[model samples]
Target: MACISSDSSDLYDVLAGRPRLTGLALAPSDDRLIASVQVINGEGNAFVPGLWEVDPAGEWEARRVTRSLQGEYAPAFAPDGRLMFLSSRENTDPFTRTSSDSTGPGLWSLPEYGEAERIVHHPSGISAFTVAHGAGTVAYTASVLPGAADTAAHAEFREKRESAKITAVLYDSGPTRFGGADLGPAEPHTFVLRPDGTQADVGGQGVVGGGDLALSPDGTLVAYTRAVAGSDPDVNANVVVVADAATGEVRRIFSRPGHHYHRLVFTADGRSLVSQRQRELTYDTPWRVTLVAFDPASGAETDLLPDFDNWPWPGSPVVSPVPGDATVWFTGDERGHCPVFRRGPDGTVTRLTSSGAYSSLCVALDGTTLFALRSTIDSPPDVVRLDAAAPDQQPVTLWAPADPGPLPGTLTEVHTTADDGFPLRAWPVLPRDASAERPAPLVVLPHGGPQMSWSGWTFGFGPWPFAARGYAVLLPDPALSTGYGQRMQERGLGQYGGRPYRDIMMLADATQTRDDIDATRTGLAGHSYGGYIANRAATLTDRFKAIVTYGGQWNLESFQAETDLHAHARRIFGDPLTQRQRYETDSPHLDVRKAMTPMLVVHGGKDYRVPVGQALGLFNDLQRHEVPVKFLYFPDESHSVGAPNHVRILYETVLNFLDHHVLGQEWHRPQLL
Candidate 1:
């Protein structure tokens, strides 16, 4: 292993030089595992996440699977042990494959011991795909231009329009954009790739967007989630349906109001389907969610863990779909630890792993071994293997080819009792040399997604470089954080200003009492929803010497009007016309006159989630009020940034802000600005 420099510059160098592991895949035989590593291509300045074979036997051996300069990802093992994935590589000969010459993702395949070959090219890019466990059938989702019968026809139409220099998107009254969409000019559809390399239409024109699709064990049927056509996708609910793979016959199996379904996975028996269902019973109910199993033939749905007190995470199913194995596995965010659990078919839920966050769960065909990507608050995710039958025993770390170098500091969690009597779990990172005799400055950093928690082991987000710069960082989970029960979320919904704000302040106040933390030199910072709280904190109190907000919103009224998923505004704050008071009360824009501490506002120009206008408008208001503030803008970035140099600049800019204000160091501006 190469030794890493202990200096804080190492943190900056890695953030700017490293590729991130996006996903993981396990062979059916459980002999090997592969992962998708996304790194920035320097020549193009674009993220190119490619597949790599990962060894979990501790040899730390790794081999690159695909060498396409254009990149490949989403690896899956075929029934015959071949690898299949999606690629957007440009074709060498434009005349032979004119359709693939365009900028669209195409399906590619590689035998166990041969070079990869292009299977079929979709005029539009393929988003997600699944391979049948038993029959080896393949199903995938793609975008199709409206009124086009096939990919070639759409390609011709697209070329004609582009040649004529047309750039208008005519629309009706439906939503112009959805929360989870590929942001293409065409509607999404699902198709079955035939064994002979042909294409079979599954959704055709009936489907408007490509939703979650799962193939049955025998490859006879597919269950997928899609919204009803001719409805507003932003506000409409998505339902699940089963379709005959060969006949294209579809059956609507599940639908409910105020509930949206995805992750449509079929059990090994093929008689039932399982989904991570989100049940938002009311507009402000937070979310009462659980895993549900539905008998497609009987049209009966059963809640897997109806009495389970915690949220089971609504994205991907943690349980491995093993034939005759009725146990469901998942991890829930409790107090501070996000623990893994195994639920018996009889509804008995048991804890599997004791602490830390887990992801990319994969189990063997017979359910004997479990592999996942695990991480903690002070570290990023890495490959790990655990006992499938009984995971209470500590898991083993897999061999990693590349090193993440060394951490800049140490992380520790502290508890503080909120005014409501419920204890708050907050993580504080201290510098390596800090002690009672030489206290370090403190920075309160809240995470984004008030609905999200701060339990995982991610090294990049915060504190790493900050602590290395002789500053202490604190991350706290308030009432609205998920994985805790629905009751805790309800207490935070419209009650943001009072509880969430006070809860964060309480944690910072407690840290001040510690002899290792300096009480006078304190800073506050947050991104997204956390940034919203940071904005409110600046106006509500001057306890911190400096504050920073990235991709945050200050005015709920205007934020709701411009946000992509505008309906959430009504769900969280009710109608701006009716519950007018709630929307205005906590908004930092309305209370900017009270702000005194110095602030730094940063935003991505392409952000549609919170909208870039929120930052520009707030920056204007702060400037109008003569508040000490600076706005850092990224023109080519989105809500989240992946470009290596952009990420490095973000960290550098943030650290410089705190260095001058909190540490009283000379302000060093990032050269990229």
Candidate 2:
């Protein structure tokens, strides 16, 4: 393999200024494709995201569509061939109060040969929308103040609150925050909008936030998910419901004691509704997910693929929208990669793509062509076309806006059997020049989610950056990782530190045995659940010279109480009073006195999921024990430090810490830090 020269190779340089294809939509005729690509504007300063039209079968020409400072999203073709999307662009409607200064995104439409116009505007803006394939009905969700029924009422309440400077929000629910934002006095409501501007509320009073909604083919019926409270106040599940779009009549189609249904889509013939059903979490049971198809007329439900073991990715289970055909398509993580699968009308499922991860799936109404964004460990996302009818033909790249150039390192896999005879695996990125005579230092990085596997391509804390610096980085998928089967995830249920920690050590042991790795100079780094494992390893072993833990749980009891999703925490760890022994056995804070390694602790101050207290307590304990420790804190960032400057500083600071501790070099503190 040819390698980029040392002086010219830089991972940041290769990744900078790369435009991403964020969304895709196929025209009604299946001849042209519309994609949302985010790119830097002419000045090369800030991003200006716009829609681009691509020729799927012709010369593969791409033409830019909408150009605005605020990007467009969720592009879809109406039955009448009009292109509709969501944007926060300035509304030209004089009667409406919303303007360019408003933050809410409104619905915009561009006809086949007409200029773009704003069709729908809400006080709180639209979150998501769906279009009927047969009829021109547009269904969307928007957040509104609790006592406000209409858009005018919502706007009135919002204006009064803003004028009064009333920033306090009183919630009657348990969760008060999500995704780094404050959960408001506002609640999500689904509504049906017509082209003529007439709208009706169809989601009913029981509408739940975050549940997906779908519009039926004929525009008469709409399917959506609603929340159902469990016996416990903190526990809640979901059920699917079908409602009349015009009459507001609704009926429950699917519900079970422990199952929640979402990601809904109606079949072309309007007879069946397909959804992803997930079993609620418990102390002993994992979140097992499967697909279920329900016939609305006959009240019959069938499990689509009972034998398929992998959990389907959230963006899938898209049913063909055209009449006379009933084909379903989805993608699932399987054995370190995401593969696309197709299920025909006769109930036979077939695997379509063999490599790379696929997302934003769009199937032609005729059910003969499919479009998706495909990406791998070495490649960025690009639009690709697949022959749904052939199933075995290769995917043709339709549009690729960005390239990472040639990677300075190559990725490979390593595996080992645990002491208990269970199989374990890890991905290693090694520089091209690595050999027996000149081995590379190893950094063992355990994946987060403990249940989420490291597969395909990921931007944050991935392996390639370290490899570009001549260090081999190993990403281990331990006992609880997905894609290997539900049995593997269940193996670590209720006990996070026992089996999963042992799996990481076993995989690291195997990697160090390779001739191209230096066992004497090894370090460990992890984030989230992986951070918990790193903290556990620090107390249990003195093998690694240095270790890094970010957003980790130090005290299990406090973490369970302060986490944003208290229900999820209780499901995995149980009640602190009833199951105190489990917390004591698994918590790293209990064994902090045994730690001997130099450690770097990183955390985001605004992170509500793990909370900043975890890092504060760990740092306090380390300082009292006279352990070599450094705390790198980001006060404004949430769980994910997504700002470009912050991310660059993070990578540089971590590399500097590792170099000083593991490579025995002088500490060179980052200027920003």
Candidate 3:
């Protein structure tokens, strides 16, 4: 059961047709492969996610895992070959629904090709589970704080408070109880289940937050990250702690301030633990990676891959089990694109793949095979397997169903110049069917996270929907993007609407010079920080024919005051009262009346990070100026537009709006005005 996009010439169609399937798991005894698949019909609606099992010979078939749960994620095979996954059941009690207090998440298990049974239930949240090799024991993180029953009420109150300053006494009402009593407190705690279904707390008493728990091959020791609440959340008081499985005796082996240790793994010998520390530095600080190995017995720590000059941003470390060969594998940026690397015991590094395709690597049991999702900027994600021992490992597509057809465009990556001559990266997808004689409409997509950058993926945001309607899409990764070093990220700290806006304008100008683009028919769109940029871009230029923003910030001052972590906001932007000029200059509201582009605003009603007020501020400003605009609010969403139905509606609305403004199509009837 493979999923493929249905729209002809759709960017998703080209990428989804690339044959990448995800959620691959292999059984230890027989080495059979099991994977979870998303099935799509000809109408482009994703049917439910299903579980599939493939024989060693590569023969496979699939069965639906949950009929009731609409969104099922993170499926894995239990040691006994049974399927275990997470799903949220719908709540219908009117009072519960209105009060924002409902509990429905549960850990469910089903026999291989059998019905699903609820194994664990929680009203709060449960995530990141690791099952022992034989399936006799399972370890997972469960939040046991009060107010788990009412997520809506909790969210509403949390939003209203401006700070996450809840009374300390209410922390004990967690959603799940193990061994007859609640874990107590809403903070995340690690728990383990024995063969008989009985559960016990694995972390020592008083351990507040735990993450990335890894069990030893023999199931005797557990390694996890322990985070203690500090006076400030931005300044994390965290350390890597290893605990004994039987006695629950804990020992702290490593500590780092303002740096997070994650992706814990035990070496084959089981004597040492390896972990990756991601260190974030401010504009005035230096960035470093301290990869350390800790001895469980003496509590001594050794630097294996210390702060090297040329280092990759490490993610999800895995260790091989073969004796005399202690190797660690992780994903990092080796040469611009994310790739998998194997660090031998001697500290030598080996690059495994070279297609420059974006890959998320996950290792199998014997360390002989690697499963990954490989994709390019113009390609949809596909699942591929790499033979670790093969001299020339070619990626074989595990799933490539029938395609909707080839896209009408060619996607190309181009290097452009920023305001200060810093090199910027942008991907431009031009219509293959377009000619120099005719001009094609263009859409400038600003990626979310002014801090994050657009990477090696082909389909971005609502670009596919517009591309299917025959518009060229341009995605830019300006100064404040990740993959580039720390300095590049901090460059836009106080220049949100300043240099960043200039860089985007330059990219737009560069795109207009292309033979296949229509300079007259240009539009802008983005979400989060991208939303902020898009709104500001509209005010800065009448060159854009249409503008759309999802969860964008309108007033930086209001955002800083309303957002969580007031302390960090003060640290990042300085006191708004003191830096009033900087805040006003960076905010889109200061120039809202200057906006000339026809605009559409979309927001999740429940978003906390940017909040709905941000969108309302922009919408009200547009209305005050008698500007042509429409606003669509999703009642059941957050910072991200999660629901499939809502996303579909958003895509349709964006396409119609772009068509009217940029393609000379019939104007979309305004919904809000």
Q: Could you estimate the TM-score for every candidate?
A: 0.95, 0.94, 0.81
lDDT of 1 at 358: 79
lDDT of 2 by residue, 181-255 (tens): 777777777789865668887754242454388877888888877664223523446667788887668854577
Q: Number of the top candidate by TM-score?
A: 1
Model 3 residue 478 lDDT score:
71
Tell me how far the alpha carbon of residue 195 in candidate 1 is from the true structure, in angstroms, after superposition: 2.1
Model 3 C-alpha lDDT versus the unseen true structure: 0.65
Judged by lDDT against the true structure, how good is candidate 1? 0.76
Least accurate 10 contiguous residues by lDDT in model 2: 1-10
In terms of TM-score, how similar is model 3 to the real structure?
0.81
Candidate 3 local Cα displacement, residue 484, angstroms: 3.2
List runs of model 2 lying over 4 Å from the truth.
Answer: 1-9, 40-48, 93-101, 204-208, 229-236, 310-315, 322-324, 389-393
lDDT digits (tens) for residues 1-673 of candidate 3: 2432334334444444333345566565535555556654344544455555554434464333455535555666666777677666554434434333335455677685556666765445565666655334667776543343333443454444435664333342222222112334455667776668777666631234444776665667767777554344347636777776655567554765566677777776677788877665432343445566777888887766654333335556667756456777766543236666677788876667665453546567677877666665555555567765443246766643334345556777667777787777677877665668876788998888665555555333645566667788887777565556545645666676887778778888888888888888888988888898888887888888889898888888888776643444555566777767667777778887788788999888777677789889899899999989899888767787744445566776887888887777997654532
**What RMSD does each model have against the real structure?**
2.4, 2.7, 6.9
| Candidates 1 and 3, the one with greater lDDT | 1
Ranking by lDDT: 2, 1, 3
Which candidate do you rate higher for TM-score, 1 or 2? Answer: 1
Local error of candidate 2 at residue 186 (angstroms)? 0.5
Residue 430 of model 3 has an lDDT of: 77
